[model samples]
Target: MQPETIKTQQPDLTGAAPAARLHQVAAFAGLSADQTAHLAQPSNIERSIADHMIENMVTTLAIPVGVATGLLVDGQEVMVPLAIEETSIVSFVTDSARKCRPAGGITTSMSGTVMIAQIQLVHVPDPYRTRTLILERRDEIGALCDACDPTLLRMGGGFRDIEVRIIDTAAGPMVVLHLLIDTRDAMGANTVNTMAEAVAPRLKEWTGAQPLLRILSNLADRRLARAHATWRPADIGGEAVRDAIVLAYRFADADPYRATTNNKGIMNGISAVVLATGNDTRAVEAGAHAYAARSGRYRSLSQWEVDAEGNLCGSIELPMAVGLVGGATRTHPTARVLLAITGAKTAEGLARIIAAVGLVQNFGALHALTTDGIQKGHMARHASNVAIDAGAVGEDVAQVAQEMIARRSINVETAKAILAERQSQRAD
Candidate 1:
């Protein structure tokens, strides 16, 4: 017997009502009624908004948002909202910040909100000669770029300078032009990209080369943010712990494997705030990792040392290409609220806060590593999740989690056993 072929039309969800779009997607994807109904529940973001935010939107995944308290940056106490699923980060960062408060908390500085746009020219007739020609036309190129964004220019931000470099690649030699622009209050991807595109034709004509890959560079070295904080030996468990932390940092600075995890711990705090504020986490991560490897070797993004007062001092510097005026920062309601809570009046202010948070977060991880080990506190917090996963609810969840922690056995099986023992005792 021959089977009949079934022709199904692909669902056109463009401009369709949210409910209609959901139904069509559900039907096309062969979702069960229960699964479809489960996804139909009220999300933190409205379906209408989510649909417009991205393509092929089926549902919104909500992450728990919590705030770290008592983070003092540049003499101001600010509460930072962190949207992440990982446990113990908020508490650890809060504790680290409190420990630093006795020594004046975290002080931060920014290297301006400058971003770079790169124009790659290949097959140039004479690469070095083209570079010289580009330098001679710096004023013209700057004016051309400045003209791309009138609002930016009026707001005291536009083209600042131009740089030309000649490099050899596997393909051949190439001439690269770097357009430095002050992005003002924006991350400036779009602004700089437009400038690069607008100036590419002129660059190609001058160099007699083909222009390719005119875009913004994620290695935002020009937009660097730095932070430093001191912790008294008495405040951070005395000289022994402080010295151990410095040693740990030395290990990370010497090895790529350790540096990767050390950098990730820093980003755990920075990325959470970036996501909560609706900024680009990937861009920040890329820039940070690239900056770490800028010295021809991968190393820690932060430094730790012992100061003259026998206190532990920590500092961090990284490329922070985050913005306040565009993208999801303006469109997401929750992001606006988070920004208000942060009290950052400009992009530079926000970057400073993020850098400070990264420094403190790294300190917290080092403190944990040198003292009680990272998993001790981490597992204690994770016990609650295991309890919930083992079918404990409400107050029972806390009871089961506590029992598991007390027993030094944090797992689903332990949680279930604890719950079972409780039920049996209640019946008796």
Candidate 2:
């Protein structure tokens, strides 16, 4: 087995390098000498497959990974690593998480980590009868599934059960089979997809229908994550601030146009952590949006309400289908570092942390929207990007950004003029 690397994560070892931090954390946790040594090695991820993992060996895409600290989930403190280019998300969420530290932080839960695989069969003569036949032979079908991945079966992860549905479409009726799998540590896409295809020949024979489109469904409603948090009125500005946040949520719930933007803000935080963990951001994104519109109306995935004690209560529920093993999570070295930083040992723990982070993020965002507005804190950070774009370097970048925010003229042109003036002064 490859050696493990423990990052230094102590109160005093804040700015230490990765190796140093790992040792500190190991010592702090009272790890054995051999275990600590095993965890202190550097990460190595080479070409695992033939161009499937990294095709053409192009340059890597870069996203700034920032630590959102002071978040307490289930009574344990965790630092979330967020990878994104958006402004103000990490800062505000970090602030809210810090303030929420004393209030027991965030509480989270999850349904079973189950994923769906759809087997589409068209041209069925008796769709209902076909459904019955498919359900009756679930054990036999499951056996075929387990045969494809003996290792997964041995690991106690395999096809859990099967479901058959007969739906009437424009042309005719189609028999859709839903295969549910307990994926355990992995996402189980390939495992379940393989299971679906293994039963295709039998499904075709049993129903006398054509089997097509056997794949995993991104609408992972079966696997859900939820988080709940409460912020006192005095803690979050005042009672008016809490009520205003509820009003903002009402606005999103009333219209799809606003709801899209609202949930996008929520994902602005969720997707960053999702990417940092090396999970499928696209799949999570698809599941989130689909779940948002699951009520036949595209609405916010979060809810804000005023409590009797006048504290602001925030809760969010979404289809959070992430994994600790398989795909990029297993293949990427940086992903390993970030996951370690988050201290999520299992897929379920990671899901809970992600959901909690998203909730705190939404909480911070709505407070800003209801009070000082999104542009102030958001644009202040945008100023730095504008300065960089205008060719400002080092100290000049900070000066130019400060000037842009002060003058309320944050644009590429303003940054360039200020940079030129600073250079002229230096020359003189």
Candidate 3:
């Protein structure tokens, strides 16, 4: 006899209710009824909004949102909401901010909110001549680009300048047009991309060059955010600790291996706020890393040194391509609340806040690394997670975690053993 064949039906989830969609997905995946209901539990974001935010939407994944206090940016005391899963980041930032508060907190400034859009013109008969031709038609090109977004122009932002360059590539020599645009209070990816597309055809018509890859460049060199802070030796564990931080920064500045991790530490703070505000975290991260490597050698995004007062000073500069409008910023309810909490009225203001947070976060990491080490504090904070993972419940969770930390052995195995001991004692 032939073997029995079974076929599973794929449910049509289009236009289905959120609960029904969950049930269908669970059934298809052979999940139990309890599992299906668990997946349908209400979250901060409504199902309809999650469905519209992206295609083929399932349930929303929730990340813990914590606030870091004592951050004084530009002479304003601000509490920043960070959406992240990592342990100790919020606590470390808060501690770092407290240490720097006596030194006037963090002073920040932004270069501008300018974003670059690149239009690659290939197969040009005369690359240099084509570049000049495009530059000469600046007025016409600006008019076309500005026409794409009249609202941006009305808001005191739009086409600012135009640049053309001819460079040799593996394929051949190509002329690239850089459209410098001030996006104002927005991240401007969409604005600049639309402008590039709007003006690409005109360039092709004028120079008989093929227009390819018209898009916004994430490098965002024109949109730089900077921050600086000083920590007195008395505040940061004396001169020895301060000098050690400078040496640690030197390692990152000299070696690419160290730089990658060092930059990641900065992003831990920047990306958390970016996610909390519904900004483009990936864009900000890409711009930051690219800016770090602009000198051909990847180096630390932040600098640390001893100031004239024998205090440790830290500064960070990176491209902050974030926006206060558009995308999920206005749509997501939690993001709107988080943005309001930061008290940033403009894109530049938000960029400055993020830069300050990055600098302080870098300082916190260096302080921990140069002192008792990172794992001590990090693992201590993570102990509760290990306790829960080991099946400790309610009050037992904290007890087990505390015991693990006291013993300096934070692991799931140890957590389980401790929980077992507590249960045995209770039974006795």
Judge candidate 2 against the unseen true structure and give its global Cα lDDT, from 0 to 1: 0.83
Encode model 1's per-residue lDDT on 1-428: one tens digit a residue: 11112111344444576577557655644556664565455554678887888899998788876567667788776767788999988877788987888788889999989999999999886898899988999999999999999999999999999998889999889999999999999999999999999999998787688899999999999999999999999989989999999999999999999999999999999999999899999999999999999999999999999999798999999999999988989877667666766778899999999998899989999999999999999999899899999999988998999999899999998899999999999999
Q: Which ranges of candidate 1 are over 4 A from the true structure?
A: 1-42, 426-428
For residues 160-248, could you state the per-residue lDDT of candidate 2 as single tens digits? 89888888899899889999888877877888899889899998887788898899999999899999988888878888888899999
- How far residue 169's Cα lies from its native spot in candidate 1, in Å, is 0.4
Tens digits of lDDT, candidate 3, 146-197 = 9999999999999999999889989999899999999999999889999999
What lDDT does the true structure give each of the candidates? 0.87, 0.83, 0.88
Which pairs clash (backbone N, Cα, C closer than 3 Å) in model 1? none
Residue pairs that clash (backbone atoms under 3 angstroms), model 2: 4-39, 5-39, 6-22, 6-39, 7-21, 7-22, 8-21, 8-22
Candidate 1, residue 289: lDDT: 98
**Against the true structure, what is each candidate's TM-score?**
0.89, 0.89, 0.90
RMSD of each: 14.2, 5.7, 14.0
Alpha carbon lDDT at 178, candidate 3? 98
